[model samples]
Target: MLQVRVKPGIEDRIRGFFPWVYRAEIASLSRKPKKGELVVVRDFGGKFLGYGYINPDVSIAIRILSFDKEEPVTPELIKKRIREAYDYRKRLYINSNAFRLIHSEGDLLPGLIVDVYGEYAVLEFTTYGMNRFREVVLEALVETLRPKGIYEKANLTAQKVEGIKVREGPVYGEVPDEIVIWEHDLKYLINIPEGQKTGFFLDQRNARKFVRSLVEPGDRCLDVFCHTGGFALNMKKMGADEVIAVDISEPALEVGRKNEELNGLSGIEWVQANAFDYLRELDRRGEKFDVVVIDPPSFAKNKHAVPNALRGYKELCVRGLRITRQGGYLAIFSCSFHITEQHLLEVLTQASYDVRRQVRVIAKTFQDKDHPWILQMPNTLYLKGIWVEVV
Candidate 1:
């Protein structure tokens, strides 16, 4: 394998078990390896460090595959990582048919995501290295788990960053047009063939369950960005009096409405419109509700756009407060990794102050157990949500 030398202080960071090697950390390279090539990582003094996957184009130049200097990045190593990640889910009692199996760097497998829905598992290979191991990983999962279906959903911008086109459908077994899965005793119709992010936001499973618990009998709820009605269906099951589900995509709304029926539910108010525009219009008309949910998509992808994202979140919160009855509840969230907990809280605080409403946080939540957060990595805990009661 080609050997790469790191700068003086960077070797310590790499030795300290940081999984990423930035291009700036490298002082010199003993060999020019191709993108996604397996390379030997070494210290500035030529001492062996570890093995990693190298990509010349990305700032995260090398994603460490093994920290052991002698260990090879083999299929066995991949299997071990997969089993370790699966064991964590098993320990958490999240044997649910639908859950995130691998969360990129969180699972020590950078640029890869796996979501298991019952007998079917969807694999998203985002990075060049992970993409290269797609077949091996799929074979290992099928062999070890005996899953009925193993499909691929590499339709993410991260794949584009690696100069890879989104490849959807079955890598093995049969691919379904709409994959159905269960969460918290709720049935959801997920179109992995057409839906977003492995077909649904399984990361918000626990938070939606929390929402279900908050609903009282005969209470009216509004779910904004109610894609596939995950939150809407939960509210319905909890016996909410009425639910107004809104989304920009008519197709998503159709699937969501079907999910409602799949769960044997009715009396949902479904509207297809721009969420921001709809919220603002509702605020202007002085329409109010007992409960409201704001679970918008990530407004900012990187740090540079966090300010704008915060502004957008603040506006959403303010409008949500405007359309909420006094002593009512609003579940607000931001999925952007660039937005910190402190930042989100501060934005909410400012929104409450501007609206002159007293808001108290009833609860705080992150992604479910399926998405593990590494101690040294805060990015894994990207989704921040708060149950705010307007007073």
Candidate 2:
């Protein structure tokens, strides 16, 4: 293994179990390192800090895998970590079989993601370092979960950043283009080959179930950026007479319609249009709904885009607030780490003041328990939502 030492101050954070070392923070290295090479990180005084894999090409140069000196970064370690993550998920006892088994840094396995949908397992390697353990990871998943098939979804952004070359297809056994997976009492069709974010937004599973409590029979509801109608179907299942689901992807909407039929439910209008434009048109038509949910894609990919992201969020909040009837409920979600819960509150406050609607927060929700987030790495806790009652 290569040996590298960081600047004096950087050691404190690494010692605190914060598992990233920026390139500029390095003071010295025994030799030039190759990308995805295992390296032992040390402090300025030559005291060991942690063991991690180094990526010389990226700003996030090193993602520490194990802080313990005894536990090194080995193929065996990857197998062990996968099993540990599986045990943790089993403990969660998620109502649905589809869940995030490994949450990157949250599971202490940086740059790896594993999501299980029924008899299949979907894998994504977000970092070049973790990609080195791909074979072991697949073997571990087979030994642990014993899924009928394993599929790899190529993340374009990760490809560009980390230079991981993986074709999007089944790597083990056979995976179908579509599969029906049930969450709570509703069934959904997941398009693994061409769907967004591993074919479905499983992170919002809890929020989808929670929204049912606010919906009443014959109530009208709106789902903006509602990929595959996760929230819309739940609203209808709760006896809402009318539900409208809007998304930009025609394929996703098609699946959403199929999901509506899969559950023997009806009256959910699936529309394919830009969510922002649709929301503006709804406000123009003076349409008011009893409940509304705006779950948009990540507006901010990185920190530089947060200002514009806030503007987008504020616009959604404004439209969501204006069209919600008095005493009705509205929920706004941000799925990016760059947009914090505080940012959501600030934007919602500004939007409410602009629309002249005083609101009180009724509830707040986050990614379900299966997607565990480490307090040391705030980025792991990416998805957050705020529910407010319009007055």
Q: How accurate is candidate 2 locally (lDDT)?
A: 0.94
Candidate 1: stretches off by over 4 Å:
none
Question: Residue-wise lDDT of candidate 2 within 1-391, one digit each (tens)?
Answer: 8999999899899999999999999999999999999999999999999999999999999999999999998889999999999998888867997999999998999999999999999999999999999999999999999899999999888899989886689999999999889899888999999899998899999999999999999999999999899999999999999999999999999999999999999999999999999999999999999999999999999999999999999999999999999999999999999999999999999999999999999999999998889888888899999999997
Tell how far residue 87 is off in model 1, in angstroms: 2.3
* Cα RMSD to the true fold for all candidates: 1.6, 0.8
Each model's lDDT: 0.85, 0.94
Q: Candidate 2: misplaced stretches above 4 Å?
A: none
Q: How badly does each model clash, as a count of residue pairs?
A: 0, 0
